[model samples]
Target chain A: EAGVTQFPSHSVIEKGQTVTLRCDPISGHDNLYWYRRVMGKEIKFLLHFVKESKQDESGMPNNRFLAERTGGTYSTLKVQPAELEDSGVYFCASSQDKQGRGNTIYFGEGSWLTVV
Target chain B: AQSVTQLDSQVPVFEEAPVELRCNYSSSVSVYLFWYVQYPNQGLQLLLKYLSGSTLVKGINGFEAEFNKSQTSFHLRKPSVHISDTAEYFCAVSENPSGTYKYIFGTGTRLKVLA
Candidate 1:
């Protein structure tokens, strides 16, 4: 089975520009998550999707960032008017319905966003 | 709330030498620990995990981690590491108490293996 796949491995855009990163999780995965890692910082959670429903979006940075999972198959994270701080590696992961130790979440190669 | 701390931002070791990466976590509730490795321009891959079995959990690529409850640590170890082991290692904790998928990750330790 293929692992999680992401498009546009690297993206460079001017400040205030918008960019949308796409993620396709493994087949039959119900839990999809988004995380970001800024330079010199830990990988922070952004949001999660259990199928088409948003489970926990408390980690979302601000209104400029939006994430959507349509048909519970793939997800897209769009950053509108992205700021310089938004530049980082965006990772998409997915796992089965299980949680904790038994749950194994597979990550994508990550989409590196560079906003200058 | 839980958080992970990796004191070593980077660790340098000669190939075939033993290496250890320290990971400390702070959480009010019980949690599950995990170690992940990421190669250059690659995604995170599970190295090993500590669920509820033995304190010493072995993982892929000849990696192992010991979960010390009292110390609140899960330090990764390799008896003899190879040059391919050079990569960024992250220590993560899953919210077991809440039964959620949210994982608290550390800043990561970049292991540089010398020839």
Candidate 2:
């Protein structure tokens, strides 16, 4: 099976600019998640999408960030008017279902966004 | 809500030597724990996990973790380290079962194995 894949592995933009990260999950997976890791920090959860509907987005940093899963095939995370604090490596993950106890969530290589 | 703590930010060990990476978690309710390894410029891969039953879980690449409920710790250990083992290891915790797969990750421990 193909693992999670992301586009534009690395990006650089100035402050107040906008950037969008894309994640294509593994085939047949229904659960998608977004995570970010700032400098010298742990990986923090951003949100989750079960199919096309967002199941949980409590981890979103602020309103400047938005996530969409159009048609439930792939997902996009957009950060508008980006700040320097928004610079980090964004990771995307996906799982098959929620029935099994030890379900595995595969992750992508991550997109590194640098806001100057 | 839950939190994971990786006490050691970095550890260096020689090949054929035993190594241990410490991890502790805090949570009011029951939780599922996991250990993920990430190579340089790569994604995170599941190393091992502790759900129930066996407190000692053996993962891929000759790595194992022992879950201590009393101490709320899941320490990863390797009897003999290898140069290939150099990577960043992250400990994570998730509440609920498979339905709520949201994970809280630790600061991560960077393990460097020397020849």
Q: What is the TM-score of each candidate against the true structure?
A: 0.98, 0.97
TM-score (C-alpha) between model 1 and the true structure: 0.98
| RMSD of candidates 1 onward, in order | 1.1, 1.1
Model 2 chain A is weakest, by summed lDDT over 10 consecutive residues, at: A96-105
Question: Which regions of candidate 1 are displaced past 4 Å?
Answer: A99-101
Error of 2 at A49 (Å): 0.3
How far does residue A53 in candidate 1 sit from its true spot (Å)? 0.4
Q: Compared with the true structure, what per-residue lDDT tens digits does model 2 show for residues A8-110?
A: 7999999999999999999989999999999889999999999999999999999999999999999999999899999999999999885663766889999
Chain A TM-score for candidate 2 is 0.96
In candidate 2, which residue pairs get closer than 3 Å at backbone N, Cα or C atoms, i.e. clash? none
* Candidate with best DockQ: 2
DockQ of 1: 0.83
Error of 1 at B44 (Å): 0.6
lDDT (10s digit) by residue, model 2, range B1-115: 5889999999999999999999999998888899999999999999999888999999999999999989999999999999999999999998755366999999999999999
Docking class of 2: high
lDDT of each: 0.93, 0.93
